[model samples]
Target: MNAAPADQIRLLDVQAFDVRLQQLAHRRKSLPEHTEIQSLTKDLTQMRDLLVAAQTEESDCAREQTKAEQDVDQVRTRAARDQQRLDSGAVTSPKDLAGLQHEITSLAKRQGDLEDVVLEVMERRESAQERVAELTERVSSVQAKADDAVARRDAACEELDGEAASVAKEREVVAGVVPADLIALYDKLRAQQGGIGAAKLYQRTCQGCRQELAITELAEIRSAAPDTVVRCENCRRILVRTSESGL
Candidate 1:
């Protein structure tokens, strides 16, 4: 394949732009906000789970307290009824009256036990409520951090995308002036050679491979026509000659 000397130089400009676009893409991926967002998202998930668990516990405790208070009320009502019956002489027989008084005493003790249960349930419910509140706040805090990180990542990516778009446009303009056959060859070689299809021959060295051309190779290049397209033997890339080629 052959291209004019000026066309080969323009190919280098296209390569430079391609390299810049690649760097921009790398910067976009490597932004710190990406990792920050990931870590924060994990923490947010865990916090939300804890908040849900705490809310469930609080709800359970509330139901338990209500049931305990109801039991206390029932026991107290029974004890009051039993005392009234004894006081009104409803049980005149000595044995019956004594039995009635004993029954009242047992009812009083039962009411006291039920009241204690209500108090215990109240304490537990209060603790559960506090835990739910704390977890809720923590979840909100973590969620806020995650949102901020995502915003930062988006902003950085937008900036990089803008720059990459501009560089791509410049590459297109530069490549448009080159012959289609030459561009096709460059693209093929670029795909095969790690992003570098053409390189400058400077001071007797192939910049693509960083190797000095042997005496015979230099002799051959020196004898080649000025408009001839030459390739480096070491790296198999198009070698564009310049005044600094030391040939």
Candidate 2:
């Protein structure tokens, strides 16, 4: 691997841009808004389940209340007819009169019992309605939160995407200055080296592997030509040299 001295130095800028791209990708994935949206979505699902259950219970309670009221109405209607007959003097015979009075008393009691049941059912239905209302409000609240999180996440994504696009365009220009073969080698090495294809040789250390170069390794590099491609002996990564290399 060999390149013009200037191309090798230019490759450093290419590598810097690549590192920046990786960092941007990592930041996008780890954004707090992304996490918040996920959590909010999960909460929304749970809230939906709870809301469905509450609605079902409320409906059932409403139906029960209606039935209870219907029963009360039926009993009261029968009692009203009995009282009408008694008041009309349709039972003049003493035995008939006594029987009519007794029947009226029984009907009144039945109506009262039915009314009590209606009241109880009404109370239960009211409670169920309250529960439904509460759950509905909660669902709305959680949905709003989820929506806000999504909006924030999207805004951040758009900003990052714009920056990434700009950086990618710059990379294309940087890549153009570097030799094709050298770029190919860097790409291949990056694939095998955990995304780090190049690093600087600074202070007698291979930054790629963070390993110090021994005297013999330093002597070899010193003897090499400036345009000759150099590799870190430890990590086999292209080691770009600069004035700060502390040769």
Candidate 3:
């Protein structure tokens, strides 16, 4: 189809804007912040898991400590009752008294052992609580980082979107200059030619296909009218000639 030489050249502007828009879109999706966000999200998940485990351990340890302390209390209460009975001279039989005294000694040893168990459990519980606290703090720290990463990722995307909006507006203006039929052709070719509908004929090569045209084809293109829309014999994309086309 015949379009003004200047109009055909304007099609290149549309192509340029479209390509820039594509690049901007790609940049928005492939930002480094996107990768950072993914990594931060993964860390947040792992950190939460660790915190949960720590909380479970602390709770279990606390229960064990309570039971241990109760065990020690029960042993001490029994020992106290035995001591009181021995002091009151309740067991008047000499053999019974001797047995009561021996029973008191054994109760004292048992109380000591239970107290030792309570101390060990308390220490373990305390350590588990400390671990929970540490993990909680770490989770908060990593959560803050993840939030920052999300903010950064969002901001970067917004900036790219804003730029793309501006480029799109420019593309609309550039596209308005070309005739409807030419745009239809360009759109069709763009769909078929990997998003490149037209390319500059730089030197002797068709930039769209990056191939040099045969001399016979070059001669025909040179001989064609200035208003003619030349297509590459190799790629069939509209070849927009320029001063550098070496026609």
- Model 1: per-residue lDDT, tens digit, 1-247? 6778899899889889988988898899899998998899889888888888889888998898888888888878887888888888877999998898888889888888888888888888898899998988888888888888898899889999999999999999999999998888888888899888889999999998899999999999999997788999998898999998999
Between prediction 2 and prediction 3, the one with superior TM-score is: 2
TM-score of every model?
A: 0.91, 0.93, 0.90
What lDDT does the true structure give each of the candidates? 0.89, 0.87, 0.89
* TM-score computed on alpha carbons, candidate 2: 0.93
| C-alpha RMSD (angstroms) for model 2 | 1.7
Candidate 2: where are CA atoms >4 Å away? 93-96
TM-score pick, better of 1 and 3: 1
Candidate 3 is scored at a TM of: 0.90
| Residue 198 error, candidate 3, Å | 0.8
lDDT of 2: 0.87
Please provide, for model 2 over 112-162, each residue's C-alpha lDDT reduced to its tens digit, 9 standing for 90 to 100: 888888788788778878888988899899899989888888898889888
Write the candidate numbers in order of decreasing lDDT: 3, 1, 2
Q: How much is 1 displaced in model 3, in angstroms?
A: 2.7
